[model samples]
Target chain A: MMKSRPIAATLAFVAAAGLLLSGCSAPAGAEAGGEKKLTFMFRGGEDEKKAYEKAVEQFEKDNSVDVDIIVTTADQYATKLKAAIAGKEVPDVFYISPGDVQAYVQNGIVKDITQYVENSDTIDLDNIWEYGVDSYRYDGKRVGEGAIYALPKDVGPFSFGYNKTMLEKAGIPLPDKDKPYTFDEFVAAAKKLTADTNGDGTLDQWGTGLNVQWNLQPFVWSNGGDWLNEDRTKVTVDTPEFAESLQWFADLQNVHGVTPSVAEAQTLDTYQRWMKGEIGFFPIAPWDLSTYQKLGFDWDVIPYPAGETGKSATWTGTLGIAVAESSKFPEDAAKLVEYLTANKEAQQSLVDAGIQIPNLKDMAEAWAADTSTKPANKAEFLEIVKDYGRELPAGNTFNAEWYDELFTNIQPVLDGKQSAKDYLKEAQPRMQEFLDSANQQAGN
Target chain B: MTTTMRRSRLHRKEHQAALVFVAIPVIGFLLFTLFPLIFSVYASFTNWNGISAPVFKGLDNYTKMFGDRYFLKSLWNTLYMMIGIPVGLVISLALALAMNRKMRGTTFFRTVYYLPVISSIAAVAILWQWAFNGDFGLINQGLSLIGIGGPNWLQDTATVKPALIIMAVWKGLGYSMLLYLAALQSVPRYLYEAAALDGATAWQQFRHITVPMVRPVTFFLIVTSIIGGSQIFVEINIMTPTGGPEFESATIVWYIWQKAFDNLQMGYASAMSVVLGLLVFTITFIQFRLNRRNQFSID
Candidate 1:
């Protein structure tokens, strides 16, 4: 009887525990105003997260809609985003990068915002760059077939930044701040800056350290060669222009010995290396300026040198705000997007964080001359961007593979184990094959 | 008759209670592991990218794996670690043999050796990164003192894999040694005495008795170590961000991680994971079979 009593008590305890776990009340806003709660997840560090939260707070104040902001790490954000989409628990408003826009559009996960953009009085469509909007567009429209999935909220454009101290030490003439160096002169100056300053048999200082992964695409684009054709259907990377650019690129490491091997560069943390003045010439994006400035180096931004293509093209990045396809209040979500992104306060907050360049033209000019920066070259930085800017080659296929694939395929050439001609020839077919398969799957 | 029948019913209830306790855990096991495994198998067949509806990709992922150069490279790298880690296990076993003897400060030495096993792998990986740095690392400084120029440890392709192997061994040896020591103590001493009675030397007795007695532990260690070593990622991730100066150090798990997480190719990554799971299953199954078939029953 005693044993039986304990067993009975145990069963009762288990039942109570289970009920305790299951019977917990849901949060107050879980089901607000009989409308389903929508979540919006984004990747940002502490300050960006706060800025976004502030925007969300303003959004809630303006509209009678509930928005749940889920913050994730930049490293894990894409995976979680994809998983959310796959699981059909997509947030009402979320962020997308240019690299994965096509996949989202094709998969019908993102709600097209074209009509909303045109109809919504709150959103000034002209405030957004046409090219930036068009980059998200597919099938000759700024949105999915007739739908707009996302709009650009912010932008990041690449610029050639140099260490003035290193140039002075190497007896190279300081770059003309007003008139930036041309392409040939940039290469010549890099060579002059390369030196064995310590009198050691090995070189002590390198003139430049090209990031083999994220930083290489601009150089490829700066040349006439590109990863894809105009239609984004085929890979045509092995053109004569591409070969010349790659050879010149390879020479920075091999012939001139001005930069480290592609392998060494892969392992090198470029910004940190650049901060210590170990690297002289760095072609970096605007977001990197915060780090560069934070490092307190004597640095200046200059326009990227032109190739035979006769125009400079720098890789640009945009933060995209997308609406989910399955949102109950697509209209409300669109309104929230409009409110959060177009709000002047929101724009200013993003600028203040230095997370990205403001999408609104009017707001950007103010960030241009914010003299609070210690370097005091804030005006020049904006001018450099104004003169030479192009968006990163956007497509469905531009992915994490964007860096790894290019690095792996092209690294052999730098090692002299394979010729540039052979490497590009092999890479073109392989890249095209990936593009074809991915696009075909996406197109369906 | 009513009382007897009631008591019989109560006994049956008690038996049922025992069954319920066991069945609950089994049910949980079925739900968590068995169900997910079955779902993963189904997922492996289809092109499910997580967001969109899955399409039938029967045998396509499996077919694509064969032609995947990176996948093959990863497989090779994983196998390299499998081979290297066991060499470490053997050294650890040798160390355990020495420690198992009643030596001075043996308890203290055991705690010191086990320190790394308890420490966070993130901390270990970070510490090793500095130690193995090519130009300004402490390891090169020590090597220079001995008049031997240390080759670029983490930077060079040839040395990167070896360096990781060394780190893996160092990190794992303590745990493996403890396992061996425990097994060694349980081994009967009479067997050793009998061998010695037959004019056997210390080496012969160790070879004949100790080796056979510890065969089970060796098998256990080898199986678990192979699984552990194949999934090596943190060291490579921390020390060599791009899987070393080249793709030389990229392993299967890291490659899968890059594909799924970095690229947002969840479908492909899941498919790769399925393949990896199968490969591990096959190897473990084969080792289990071999161990069963060739049991050295010294007892």
Candidate 2:
């Protein structure tokens, strides 16, 4: 009887713990509102949230549909989205980066919105930038060939922002509007601009600052070296053009000593240094316009320098809005996406706030020509978009894996520990194997 | 007969009440812990991308680990970080002994030592990242003042692990010290007195009495510390956003997290997690056996 008493107590404790835990695992469901509710998830900061909130409010009033918005930090967005998908609670409309669009589409999480786009009387597919529209198109074998699954939020063109004051102080002429500096000219200008302002042995100002992963695209693409073959079936990182571009980029830090060392860069990040007018040329996107407006020095942007091919090349960063396949109200979600991406008012609101470039081709020219905007030469962004811009290798399903591998392995080469040729040579076969496997898995 | 029946009825009521009390927790355990564990084990054998249905892949996921350089490197990094555990234990024991004495401000000292344990890991990692910065950092500035050039603690491959270990040890010291203090306080004074009566010195008494008496506490500390140390994630994630300069600080859990969440390779991550679980289990089992053998020897 005593043993029974202890057993009963143990059972009570276990039962209490189990009940509490079960409560924790209770399934999350959408609120049962009288009006049709649409859930939208996005990655952004406070500014983005504010812009989205205003747009969503307008959307709700016009359509009489309720929107449940979920905003998460950029780092947490992917994990949260995956969890939502796994739990069968995916948002009706969600932001999908170009890098993730292929995988999401392949996994059957994104709905094909081609028919919706064609049927919608309000949406003119021709008004949107081809790059933005094509970013979401994915055939079984490659991108830019199949059904459109999403609409781009913006066309983020990477251009070079230079401190005009620094150029004037160095007695160097500003780069020509149409013809920016060639690779040699850019390097020479950078060398001349590099200075030791405090007369200390150490340099207080640098020629430029660039992230190997984010800013290297211009150099690689300008050199006519790409991450994948034309059809995206294989990795092509072992070519001489790719190796030479990587080496030249690294030499800007190691051999030329123009840029700050990795250790020095860690102490004060390049963004802060750029704000302090310490860098001569730094990569800037349209989104960074507001931040740069606060900088005390005179600054203007130019297209990325011409490389060995004598052609300026750049990459466009695109984030698209897609309807989830599991959405109960996919039609409504598609309408929300159309309103967010195709509506002139919504695009203008984002552009006027310096949040993003216009997704519509017609609006981009006017937005860039707004002289009241900072960077005085905002038109260069449009030039890059219309002429030299291409989507990142991540546009393909398996290409992001290859891209990440390069970024991971290229650190040694950038640090001058290994030659670019040797490193890429070693990594090429492994990358090819990975891409082959990904293709096989996709039955391509 | 009526009294016996009354007692039986009361016992029956008590039993029912107890069953009702425990039912919630048992159901919770079955739903959250047990179910997820079983699902994850099953998932380890499949190729699930979290969004799509899992497809059985037999031992493919497990076999991939044998050739995965990053996985092997992360395992090494995890074991490297465990070096901090024993070092932390010794430092905490020493501090606990000193603070356990009947001195003025003992409580204040105890509180000060326990502060890090209560503090948030994200805040601590960010603070330490600045302190460990190669240039314009407090640590480097101090080192330069003493005629020593500090290496780039977080960026350099050679020093990144040591930097992480130092941070881990510092963060863990408070909790370890409090545990040791509790164990120290419970040690009977009679054993020490007997040792003193035997003409033993202070060190001799401490060695003979305090050390042996704290064996069980030490065993508990080592087991828990090893488990916790192997799962180091937050500190590395915040301090080294790219997994350190050359993947120097990538631990097994961090790798699993990256694979599962960042790359969407949930099944592969589950397989790696299962392997990690086995590794931790083996180490803990060996420690338990060693502890038991030591106890038997003492008897």
Candidate 3:
């Protein structure tokens, strides 16, 4: 018995460690390894994965190189990517964000690709959204000034969508396509539509169900309030206009009764309510199109309700296709990025999969002009993308800690426990500290 | 003389084999655990952004932790959730006492209690998240039967910690109970009989005999529970992705993780992690120091 005990114990431990090591390495599979191999990591849903798989297959065939696709869910992608980078198994090309450009450039994690784009005959710089392209431009001192580190994957305009059936049922006129509703008019409509449809002594339908994080930008911007000033050095969210806009957003749920309460929202969130035709309005991004296409209710897009400025405004978001600086084949990776971002076929496939609007202006215009889709006002998304859709304030800053601070304590305002003015007054200085630290970190 | 010489040689061979066996795990421990521990200490004093080279920052990251509201709040939240440890132990010990009896269907009840322990924490967290939904949740529906409206468990700042505590206690009850059960079985029956023979009242005999018998298990459970409680993260991330309502549910680890990956503040996170490691080590050291006087060393 003693003779075999050591072997058995050692074997058991080896087996256990083998399991752990194998499990850890399992997700990092390189399919059909070859001399010319490239790894592309990106985050999205099943439809997006399917779409990318097809596009990647075409790119591989065209380039005569092996491409390994690593698809991760949205929530876990950032963590997984960071782990990969830290572990020194960095993917050749991955989705990057503008907000991370300064730090990424400083770290040499991403390669500068200004020369590749300038030399490529297939890519027309003007065809891509200028703002989207500029978001990835980092000059070491500023984000949007110098050489490019990544190419825009897609410039997604966060559009406002409303339920047509609910509006019609409430005898409310449909929102105009070109013009936005004034805050008062929007509230009036919301109040009109928020009634107990089945007379169960409970609210089953609400005019709007907006999550503050994703939906408050339009109101704040339209009210002539912004998170940062022109140079992006100072936080300027403590203004009276910002407070008034924030108060109005809070009043939608607390005082106006237009939105679902915190308790009410905990059951079926605002997004679910919108899908079920219970909510009048919700924010819609291009990435949401595939999932939202399956919604039971008929919905259409509109500009968000205007505030004090009488102008519609909202944020545009984008993910950049970045080539890793440590890649064995950076030029190949850069070519793949160029193809993904600028190629007509790849952009069309992504759009056809309902994941995004086309990157090319000509294709986007043609796609928006088509009226057969569920959202008849596709032109509104186009208009926002083409004209007034501004980058989120976080995109301009060195880091988003300062941007994220604004919402950390703002729940009290939404809960009616704190006033917007007092909250903003306290918030700006705290944000400034993070901003200052971030600025210092960036050596600004 | 030949047999003796052969036996001694065999002994030497066995000793070498034993050393080899011990060395495998020792090497792994040193490489993975010891190396990381030492590296993190060095990293805590530097402005390492996890991408580029690190710059030395002296005590900046460490000193900054005190003034960070998020860090303080998260630390408080982590400690607040540790309330579950004591509550879990008490209930589990009581359960162990009850289950020690020759009862019907004891195995089934044991399995039922332990099911949560074996289940994946991610799945359990997701299930609890659904159950704690304010309006149409199982918890609120149960409360409605009693005509008492339950506040939104995971969303409301007042209840998020309590909700997490309740879940932690529930999930961990069976493991501690199992340990206590084992300890109870191992206790000699003679002590109880001797106590009863001395004309001791039921309460006194039970208290003196049973409680003393189970002291080792209690010590063990408390130390481990505190260590586990302080590092709580996965549930907070799963249930409240934005760090709960007003950041009430965010634990120290979750905040560290957010700062590291989300904010790209790896230096700050590494410093926080060092503090957490030291705190956990100190607490564990204190427990060991106190327990050194007690009987039944873990080794």
Candidate 4:
């Protein structure tokens, strides 16, 4: 009996070990709730939460309904939100990305809010940015062209920022607002900005430090290189223009030595360097304004340096506020979305809080015209919005795997270990494979 | 007859109480462990995207695993880290011998050694992440004191795995040292005296007496550590989130987690998980057999 006891305990322990083997996740089950309460989940920082809380407070007061706010950090948001959906305990309204529209629609997770949006008195579809609104539209096969699934919470114009003080110190003239600096002119300015002012045996100042994921877009687009062909069926990153853009991006660090070396940058990343007046150029977005307001150095947005196309380019990032198809109070949820997205007072509060660009065209134009803001080139954000802002290449695809592939093995090129042309030659087939798989999954 | 009937009723009542006690673990074992095992086996053969109902696809996920270089790389990385297990055991055993002597501050040393084992892994990983930083990190600064320019520990593909291994060894030293200490104290001193009288050298006495005496504890630690080490995720997740440079530091569990949660490829992740399960079970089963044989031969 004693021998059997030990053996049986060991057996139980082994069986218990099996628990972790197969259970990928045991998402929390549904919790009890009141009859009329709506769950609103989103990902944001404290300022965004406060802005949203103000808007939602009005929403609850006007509608006489309860809204339970479930805020999460951006990193954990996707996992938690997906777990909720998979468990069939989805929130009434949640923030979604445009990239997931196909799967969400296929799974009946998102409701078709076309009627709600069209009939919403506060939400004038015509007044909102067409780029923002159309991102949620999907026909059965194509994205960006059919019934709307969600409303835009905000349209984030990814803007280029330059240190005004650094330019003044270097005796460099400010860039033109009407016309972007050519690539050569930008590089020359960057070279002048790069110096060892502290004499620490290491260069303390850098021209620019750009991450490939976010900052590479303007360079690629202005150079007439794109990740996908129009009609969105082919992987087109293997073009010479793309290689040239990529090599130039790398050359800023490897050839020109304008940006910080990898080892130096590891200690303090480019963003931190820019914050400390060590980096001359960085990317800024609407979300950064609240933090950037407290900077020790003066800075402002500029047109991205131009390439062969002779025009500035950047991508607009938008978060979609969606009502789940299974939501108990779809009308109230839709109203909240409309209010947060389009109501003048709500939009004004959000814009003043520096959480977003205005969704309404007239309000945005007015906001851009006011030169009192630190950016001083708010019109550049408007220009991108009205003319040059494009959706990221992944936004058009069924899944982002193909687009994400561009950066997965890009270190070799960026580190100057491999030529950009050689890297792209190898990268295209892999990207094509993912794109083809995505197509098949979408039943294309 | 009346007395016997009353006794029988009391016996039945006790039997029912014991049954209730036994049922909890059995039910948990079935629901949480066995059922998931069966369901995942079924899931491994499907194309479930975690959002929709699974569609059956025979042998595709398995065949793909063979060609998946990331899967192979992660598997290799996981096994490569097990090199630290034996190295850690050797060091801890030596520490255990030193600690077994009647020395001052043994308890203080014990506490210090075990501190990392008790510390929350997330917090330790964060501390280690900064400590592994190239320029300003604690590790590099120490190396610079000795006139060696330390490479970037976490960022460089060549050094990332070794950095992780060092951290693992340091964190695990305390627990193993404690176990070995307990095993050493239980060993009869007279055997060592007899070996000494027989003119056995200190090293020979250690090899013949001390090593064999601690064999069972060693077997236990090895079995448990191998199992525990294979499921290493939190440190990898917190430290090298994007799997480090060139995916060099990516372990099996971290990759499985990324595939399952981030990519929503639950079906493929399940297949990978089942393979890991089989690998762990096979290794454990072999160890058990070997250990039983050793015990029998000793007898």
Clashing pairs in 1: A85-B51, A86-B50, A86-B51, A112-A147, A112-A148, A112-A149, A113-A148, A316-A392
Report how far off residue A55 is in candidate 4 (Å). Answer: 4.6
Q: What RMSD, rounded to one decimal, does every model reach?
A: 3.9, 3.8, 3.6, 5.5
Model 4 TM-score on a 0 to 1 scale: 0.89
lDDT of 4 by residue, B135-230 (tens): 567998999999998987887878999999999999999999999999999988899999999999999999989999999999999999999999
lDDT of 1 by residue, B24-67 (tens): 67866896699878876777777765566777788887888889
Task: For residue A320, give model 1's deviation from the true position in Å.
Answer: 2.0
On the 0 to 100 scale, the lDDT of residue A389 in model 4 is 90
TM-score of chain A of each: 0.85, 0.90, 0.91, 0.90
What CAPRI-style quality would you assign to candidate 1?
acceptable
lDDT of 3 by residue, B1-299 (tens): 99999799778767866876788789789978999888888889998877767789999998999988899999989998898998999999989888889989899999988899999999999999989888667998999999998988887889988998889999999999999999999988888888888988989977888888789889999998999999998888988887888899999999999998888788889999999999999999999999888766322
When 2 and 3 are scored with lDDT, the better candidate is 3
TM-score of chain B of 3: 0.94
lDDT of 4: 0.85
Model 3: lDDT to the true structure: 0.87
Report the number of the highest-DockQ candidate: 3
**lDDT measured at residue A126 in model 1 versus the true structure, 0 to 100:** 80
Question: Residue by residue across A1-444, what tens digits does model 3's lDDT show?
Answer: 766577667768777877787655543224346457788999988888888898899999999878888899888998999989887788999999988898888888999989999888768998888888998998878888899999999999999988887888778999997889999999999999898999989899888887778778899999999988887789999999999999999899889898876645443467677877888888888888878878887889999899999999998898899999888887888899999999999998999999898989999889888887767888887889778899888886767899889987787898889999999999999999889878877882
In model 1, what is the error at residue B261, expressed in angstroms? 5.1
Tens digits of lDDT, candidate 1, A294-345: 6645777766666766565666667788888877778888887776677788
Return the clash pairs for model 3, or none: none
